[model samples]
Target: MPTLTRLLSIIGLIVTGAVLSMYLLVSYVEPEPREIIVEIQKEGFE
Candidate 1:
């Protein structure tokens, strides 16, 4: 049916846009480096 084909096309377009945006973000962004420290209680090992 025409309706089913239209719905599939819309969904495909949305998915394509999402993937393109994510690829751009991944390819162009840089993350800052930071040190993290955590303290654990010794009693938890028992």
Candidate 2:
């Protein structure tokens, strides 16, 4: 029972750490802006 409890606690801590790190990355990171262009065939415009 003690081993099972320890294992669950370790797993919970690892999951919590992962979630916190992901939250930090999402909150702090930024993406570059860019312009995009597309070409269409003349037939498609008809």
Strongest candidate by TM-score: 2
- How high is the CA lDDT of each candidate model? 0.65, 0.66
Candidate 2 C-alpha lDDT tens digits along 1-46: 9999999999999999999987666556633211111123444666
Clashes of each: 0, 0
TM-scores, all models, native as reference: 0.61, 0.62
In the range 1-46, model 1's lDDT, one tens digit per residue, is 9999999999999999999987666556633212111123334554
State in Å the error of residue 37, model 1. Answer: 23
Which candidate number maximizes lDDT?
Answer: 2
Q: At residue 9, what lDDT does model 1 achieve? A: 100
